[model samples]
Every structure is written in C-alpha cells, then in structure tokens.
Target: MTTNTTPPIPMDALRTLPTPELGMLLLERLGKETRFLPQNITAEARIAFKGESDEADLLDRVCEAWAWVESKALVSQVGTKTSDFRRVTTDGRKLVADPSALVRLAAADRLAGPMHPALEGHVRTNFHLGQYEIACFAAMKEVEVAVRDTAGLGHSEIGVNLMRTAFKPHNNGAGGGPLADAGAEGGEQVAMAALFAGAIGVFKNPTSHRTVTFDDPMEAAEVIQLADLLLRLVEKAKVREIKTENE
Candidate 1:
C-alpha cells in the first residue's frame, strides 16, 4: 500500500465558499469572527485576485489577501511587538492590527527610533521613507564614493547642480520625483567648510564668536565631507590629541 502525500490547501479555494462562509473564515482567522459572507465574485477585490484556493475556499482566500500584503515587503507590526510583525500573514487577527510598512514609516518617530539595527543595510539603505531624510544625504555621499571608484566618472562632488541633476532621472508625482531637501546652493561642502572654519576660528581666536554661514550647496557638500573626514580623523587620533567637539 502506498501512503498518499498531498500538498497543503491553496488559498484560492476560499472563493468557492458562499459569502457567509468566507466572511466567517476571515473573521475566524482574523479573530473578529463574523457571520456575513459575500457571494459577489464580481467584486473588484475578488476579481483582481489570482491565487490557489482551499476548502470551501474561505480560509484560503483570506490567506491570499494577506499574501498580497506580504509581497510588498511593507508589512509591519503596530500597536504590538515588533517581533510579532513576521506573524501578520500567518493569521488574520495579526494582520488586522499589523498595518503596512508605510504606516509604520509615517509613525516612525513614535513607533521606533532612528534607523534601528533591523533596517536593511542594502538597497535603499534606509530605515523609513518619510523621516529618514538623512539617508538621502548619506546616499549622496555613497554615490560620490561610487563615482570616484568608476574610472571615468571624475568623482565629482555632489554640488547643488549635480544633486538636483541626480534626481532628474526619476519622475514621481507632479512630474518630479519625491526627494529630501537639498540644502541651499554651494551645498553640504560649503556648510561643512564654514563649520570647520568656526571650530578652527574658535581655536585661533577665542574672543571672536561670529556665527559661520554657508549659502551655497556646493560649499555645504564640501563642508560636510570635511567634517566627516575630520570626525574619522578624530576617532583615530590619540586620546590626548583629540580636541574636536565630539572628542
């Protein structure tokens, strides 16, 4: 005698069940457990779905919907443990309260802190989209490194013109891609240069306390680079020799 081994029930099967059954399954899995069932297969949501179904298909379709949410990789646990995020798709109850990654990103200030260790280090190199504007600046720096590495790219500094041009390739809503604010012209270098000058000025003349200002994007980018480089230098310097603000 041969023992039969069958694959698990497919989510698409859920559709075969009447509306009452489907609704109950959804509620049962989601913990809201309702008796209503929707038999209208012509509904936009049902019509759009394409997936395998399981017994009476109610339970299966619920899984299918959750699968759609998971495919976006934008799933997150809200009003609950972050560790529970992964459990959202397994059960309906979890998804009901889980919310989307976009939601979490919007509430990032309260849901979590800046770029927790859990964020992906690859791809976007960002923890959240709405509040992680620093990542945009960081991306510019990484791009600079990449350009430098390429033999023909000239390793140009991400000045205002270059920074704005960098975004030209992408067009989002309103014919322009969404992007972080690139500080005023002369850019990061200019800003950093001024900051460094201030720090240096402080050392040179402790009596003159004029505030430093950079009005150009290119200048700001240069300043940022200098500051970063100096920070690295300070990090490497001997304990007694370190005199920077962070030191």
Candidate 2:
C-alpha cells in the first residue's frame, strides 16, 4: 500500500493569510491535481490545514480563496456543465511558474482603480516596471507642469517657489495670483498656497535634486493619487481663471 505522507498545513497560519495568498495556495494544489471540484478542494484544504475545530470557518475561507482564483480567471470550469470541477488557466500556470508575477499582479491590481487621465499611462508604466520613485516623480511633474501652464509662469519658476507664486493670495487691495481664488478670504487663499507649496516642496523637489527611494509600491500609488488630486485642482483653477477673464 502507498503511504500518504503529506504534512498538514497549520490552520493558524492559513487564518491570517491574505485572500490572494490563500488563492495561490489553492492554485498550487490545483496545479498538481489538474482538475478538482470546489467542495473537494475545500475538504482537501480542511484536512491539509488541520482544521478539526471551526471546520465551517475553514471551509468558508477555502471557498472564498477559490472564488478569488476564479474571479481573477486563474481557474476555468472543465466543461460546459455547471460543474464545480475546474482547471488552472494558462495565466495561472505562468503565475505558478514565476512567483514574482504575483508581486506584479498585486501592483497592477492596486492601480486598477480610476486615476487622472494624465497619470493613467505614465505613472502606471513606471510603477509596473518597479520604478516606484520615478512613478511618483512623473506624477508630481505633471502637477508642476499643470500649475505652470495654468498660471502662465515660465519654466524658470519651478518647485515650491512656483507653487507659492501661482497660488499666492490677494493682499493689500492687490489681485491674487491667476490660480488663486480672488473671491475667497485671504486666509483661505493663503491656505491653498501653502497646500500646493507644501506638496511640491515635499513630494516634487527632492526627486529633482537627488535619488529618492520608494520601496513600497502602495505608498508610491498614494503619492500618485495625491498628484492626481492636485491636477484636478489645477484644472479647477484654470476654469476659474477663464470665468474671471470672461467677467
């Protein structure tokens, strides 16, 4: 008789694993089996996870992980019938062959949400290429260009100074900068200037003078999203300038 010698995976560890990780675990198992029913997979996971207590919870998590794999198109039904049997997809096999692909997949998933039209290509390409710092730099560069173009400032006016000058509040009966909201209170306008100036000073300036590092892709995505918001603000400022000119 053949001996079954596979070691049981600890349930404690499986409980804490992220959905994607759990999905990958299931995918790995499916890759070995070639085809499997969802319930059988869940049973197998329960046994492999050593889930004697809270079996229902373990089964639910396994099912959820399986669903995530299916949602990602990593697995496909084996036939035309409404059957639970599924086989790993070509992409799934590729992912299994190269574990690093999971990192790229996660990065792509993080950036899958809606972004500013300006950043959709530039930031994402750099981010996907693992150029996190360059991704952030490219995003903030867009903000700087939008600010300069909206305020009609020359390229010589750059960085924090450019942001301050472009968004400077009205004072002493003098008109505010082109991007500044003239109708707003001086304090509010000053706050806007400080907001833009601070963002440029912190996020944009260092990337220009030195090599900045961004090890965390999620953090880099947040920086890009911030740039997206600034771009929208610049567009609003441009619209306000046009309206003011018409008036």
lDDT of each: 0.34, 0.81
Residue 175 alpha-carbon offset, candidate 2, angstroms: 1.4
RMSD of each: 18.0, 4.5
Clashes of each: 39, 0
The sequence of per-residue lDDT tens digits that candidate 1 reaches over residues 66-141 is 4544453323344345333233233344334543432332233232333222222521334233223333244334
Residue 42, model 1: lDDT of 21
Give the least accurate 10-residue stretch of model 1, judged by summed lDDT: 175-184
Per-residue CA lDDT of model 2 for 112-202, tens digit only, reads: 8888888988788889788988989999999999999999999999999999999989996797788999888899999999988988898
Which residue runs of candidate 1 sit more than 4 Å off their true CA positions? 1-60, 66-125, 128-131, 149-156, 160-247
Give the range where candidate 2 is weakest over 10 consecutive residues by summed lDDT.
1-10
